[model samples]
Target: MSNEPVSVGDKAPDFSLQASRGRTVSSAELSGRPYLLYFYPKADTPGCTTQACGIQEALPALGRLNLTVIGVSPDPVSKIDKFADKYGLEFPLASDPEHELADRYGTWVEKSMYGRTYFGMERSSFLIGADGHIKAIWRKVKPADHVALVEKAAAEL
Candidate 1:
């Protein structure tokens, strides 16, 4: 499967979705701050949790750089809420149940687990500038040190 990826210097695609914060977050509302938009497979899973909590732990430093962290997954709002609460994750975790945002950003993909191949959301992240342009793109990310990388990118912004 191939997708036309959003790249550095490209204008970020607009989106409006339900976030665990109980708000409909839109690209327009995120215009004034550098934002990190990360897409993961599911809530409360190992790698996804690791990636999310990493961002959570680094939120303070990221915020100091005026960066807003947001996570998107196909899970329903209920699951997203539970995961956020369980982890004390303060960032907005948006629900992309239809994966419109993921498809637009090229995070939707095909994967295999024990020979079961299916379409799914790839673990990815996009750093969007205050001007709404893609600043960086990370694909096939490692959850462990992911947050630190985002923090470093925020520092450069």
Candidate 2:
């Protein structure tokens, strides 16, 4: 895979991730429908929780627009399950424990914190059009701004 991040208008990378509620979410299954795929560093953290709850709160509005939302994290299935259950998140919370999906989506990235370097999932999101092409990309997203931004993009789609 190229090191470059996925750009808008490119066909989104296909993914088949295990999600909460014993579900499997795949790009093939989502074909011909608009959706939001968001990546967060971890589950149940403050920022992640804020972003997730915001998405959950906006689900009704998003549904009215025929948009589905999926939250992706490096956490395992058990952790993702707990987080979704605890927050009462109705949308799919996908586990990317191996980060294969992250890498494919270009959300897996390098970082430095307090003089140390490591790799982690960047807070990012992709708004995919019904035709399976990416309509928008958000890198290093802020939890506070995620919902409104995605909602607008989905609306445009």
Candidate 3:
């Protein structure tokens, strides 16, 4: 890994991953619109639920900004499928089981829990411009207020 923070104005890496609904989503395909690319650790967890639901509820407002919201995680397609159905998540959830996209965005890093250090996906989000450049990046995000914060960022863009 390069240990580089994918900063504002850097070209966002393009990737394709299986969606929770059995389709493939790619950065190249989401042309001519800004997007909020968020990385979460797991599917169906309490914190993750709060974050996803918040975004779901704010979809309309976010749409007015011409932004697409996408959630990425290291969970398998099957798990993500269930989580999406259970929560009625309207936004697409992409699977990155091998952490390729997460690593590329620098969201995968060493994390600590209960005094134990381990590697995991550090919750993060990026505001990617229509031209494929990153407009903003949020690292180690707090799940509860994530949606509101993302909305704020999008409004500024």
lDDT of each: 0.90, 0.93, 0.90
What would the per-residue lDDT of candidate 2 be over residues 31-77, giving only the tens digit for each residue?
99999999999999999999999999999999999999999999998
**Model 1, CA-based lDDT:** 0.90
Q: Highest TM-score, which number?
A: 2
Error of 2 at 29 (Å): 0.6
How big is the positional error of residue 30 in model 2, measured in Å on the Cα after superposition?
0.4
* Candidate 2 structure lDDT: 0.93
Candidate ordering by TM-score (highest first): 2, 1, 3
Query: Distance (Å) between predicted and true CA of 144, model 2?
Result: 0.8
TM-score of every candidate relative to the true structure: 0.96, 0.98, 0.96
RMSD of 2: 0.8
Displacement of the residue 135 alpha carbon in candidate 2, Å: 0.1
Instruction: Give the per-residue lDDT of model 3 (tens digit) for 1-157.
Output: 5546688999998899899787888988897789989999999999899999999999999999999999999999999999999999989999998888888898888998899999888899999988899998888889888988888889988
Off by over 4 Å in 3: none
Which residue pairs in candidate 1 collide? none
Query: After aligning candidate 3 to the native by TM-score, how far in Å is the CA of 117 from where it should be?
Result: 1.7
Q: Which residue segments of model 1 deviate by more than 4 Å?
A: none
